[model samples]
Target: MNPVATWRRLLAEFAGTALLVTAVVGSGVMATTLSPDDVGLQLLENSVATAFALGALILTFGPVSGAHFNPVVSAADWFLGRRAGTGLTAGDLGGYALAQTLGAIAGSILANLMFDLAAVDFSGRDRSAGHLWLGEVVATAGLILLIFALARSGRSAVAPAAVGAYIGAAYWFTSSTSFANPAVTIGRAFTDTFAGIAPASVPGFVVAQLVGLAAGAALTLALYPGVGQAADEVVVAHDGGTAPTHAGRP
Candidate 1:
C-alpha cells in the first residue's frame, strides 16, 4: 500500500471511531438524563441508537479505511490477511491505537459536556470478575462472528449493518452490556455517563475481549476453513498496483 493511502486510512479510522464513541456514549448520557424510572430501557434505547449510528458511519467510511473502529477488529483483520500488512506495521499500530484511545476520550468529554453529566462519578462502577468475564466473551465472540460471516460471504457491502445489528442485539443478550471495543471501553472510563466503565477495570475487560476474539477467529477458521482467505480479498491492491477503488473487491 502507498504511504499516502495508509495515512488517509489511519485518519479515516480516527475520525470514524471518534464519531462512533461520541454517538454511543453521547446517546447513553442523553437517555440517562431524560428517562424517568426505567434505566434498563434507557440503556436499550441508547444501545440501539448507537448501533444505527455506527452502521451509518461504517457505511460512509468503510470503503476508505475498512472502518475498523476497534483495535481487536484491526488486529483480527491483520490476522485474516485483510489489511495491508505494511500499513499496519508497529508504528502504524501505535498511531492507530493512540488515535483511537484519544478519540474515545474526546468522545466521552463531548458526551459529558452535551449532557451536563460531568458531576457523575465513574470510578469503581464497572462489572468485573465472574459473570462479567463470561459476558465479555459472548459479546466479543458475537461481534467477530458477525464480521467474519459478512466479510467471508462477499457481502462486504452490508458489513456495517450486520455488525451494527449484532452489537445492538448483544447489548440485550450479554450480562455485561456488550463492551465490544477496548478503546471505547477505556474512553467510557473517563465519563460518569450511562456507558461508563471504571478505569481500573478496563484492563480486565480488554483482556477478555482479546480472548474472545481469538476464540471467535479459531471457530471461524474451523467452521469455514477457507473463509479467512476469502475475507482477505477485500483489501488487496488492484491491477494498476494502486490501492483498489471503493467499488473494487481486493
Candidate 2:
C-alpha cells in the first residue's frame, strides 16, 4: 500500500474510534441524567443509542479502516491477517492500537466536557466482579464470531447491523452490560458516571476481553476452517456479468 494510503487508513481508525467512544460515553451520561430514577431505562437508552451509532460508524468507515474501534478487534484483525498471510501489516497493527487508545481517552474527555464535568475524572465506581468478567468473555466472544463469520461468508455488508444488534443485545444479556472493547473500558475510566469503570477494574475487564478474543478466534477457525484466508476477499465483476471472489482487503 502507498504510504499516504496507510496514513489515511490510520487516520480513519483514529477518528472512527473517537466517535464511537463519544457515543458510548455521551449516551451513557445523558441517559443516566435523563433517567435518574431508573437504571433500566438509562441502560436501555444508552444501548439503543450505542447500537445505532455503532452501525452508522461501521458503515461509514469500514471501507477505509475496517471500522475496528476496539483494541482487541484491531489485534485480532492483525493476527488473523498475519496468520493467513493477507491481513494488516505489523506497522499498521501497532499504529491502529495506538490511535485507538488515544482516541478513547480523548472521547472520554470530550464527553465529560459536554456534560459540564471535569475533563478527566478518575472513576470511583467499583465494577470489579467475577460475573462481570464472565460477561466480558461472552460479549467479546460473540462479537468476534459475528465479525469474522460475516467476512468469511462474503456477507460483510450486513456486519454493520449484525454487529450493532449483537452489541446492543449483549448489553442486556451480559452481566457487565457488554464492555467488550478494551478501548471503551479504558475510556470509561475517566468518567465517574453510569458508564464509567474504576481504573482498578480495567485490568480485569481487559483480561477477560483477551480471553474472549482467543476463544472466539478458536471457534471461528473450527466453525469456518478457511475463514482466515478467505475473509479478505472481494467479489469483482469480470469481462462478463459474473462476479468472482478474489483476495482483497476487507
Candidate 3:
C-alpha cells in the first residue's frame, strides 16, 4: 500500500470513530435530557438511531479505511485476514488506537457541552465483576459474530449495517450497555456525561472487552475453519505488490 493510502485510512478511522461516538454519546445526552417519564424508551430510541447513523457512516467511509472505528474490530479484522499485513503494523495500530481514543473523548466532551450534563455521574451504579464480565462477553460476541458472518459470506458490502444492528440490539440485551470498543470505553472515562464511565472503572471494562474479544475470535475460528485462509491469501497478494513485509492473518 502507498504511504499516502495508509495515512488516508488512518484519517478515515479517526473521522469515523469520532462520528460514531458522537452519535451514540450525543444521542444519549439528548434522550436523557428530553425524555419526560420514559428514560428507557429514550435510551432505546437513541440506541437505534445511533445504530442506523453508524451504519451509514461506515458504508460511506469503509472503502477508504476498512471502517475500523474500534481497535477490537481492527484487531479482529487482522486476525480474520481482511487487513493486509502492512496495514496492521504497530505504527498503524498505534495511530488508529490513538485516533479512536481521542475521537471518543472529543465526542464525549461535545456531548457534555451540548446537554450541560457534564456534572452527571457517568458510571453505572452496578459495577460488579460478574455483571461487567458478562456484559463484555455478550457484547463482544455479538459484534464478532456479526462481523464474521457478514465477511465470511462475502457480504462485506453490508457489514456496516449488520454491525450497527448488532450493536443496537446488544445495548438492550447486555448488562454493560454494549461497550464493545476498548478505546471508546476508556475515552468515556474522561467525562461525566450521559455516556461517560468513571475513570476508576475504565480498566475493568477494558479488560472485560479484551477477554470478550479473545473469546469471540476463538469461537469464530472454531465455527468457521479455513474461512480465514482465503482472506489471508488475498491480503498477502495485495500487500506483495509495493508494500512492506509483514505477516498476514490466518
Which residue pairs show backbone clashes in model 3? Answer: none
Report the lDDT of model 3 for residue 104: 77
* lDDT of candidate 1 at residue 32, scale 0 to 100: 71
Q: In angstroms, how far off is 70's CA in candidate 1? A: 0.4
Clashes of 3: 0
- Candidate 1 or 2, higher lDDT? 2
Shift in Å, residue 25, candidate 2: 1.0
Q: Please, what are the lDDT tens digits per residue for candidate 1 over residues 1-250?
A: 3334767777877788878878988888778768858888898889889889988988766666667778877666666654434324455566667777777777777777777666334645766776887898888877877776556656666676778888888888888889878888888887866788888789889999999889887877776555545443332221222322233232
43-100 per-residue lDDT for model 3 (tens digits):
7878887899888977766666667778886676566654334235556667878887
> For residue 136, what is the lDDT in candidate 1?
89
Location of the lowest summed lDDT over 10 successive residues in candidate 3: 232-241
Candidate 2: residue 77 Cα off by (Å): 1.5
Q: Model 3, 187: alpha-carbon shift in Å?
A: 2.0
Candidate 3: global Cα-lDDT? 0.68
> What's the number of clashes in each of the models?
0, 1, 0
Candidate 1, poorest ten consecutive residues by summed lDDT: 235-244
Ranking by TM-score: 2, 1, 3
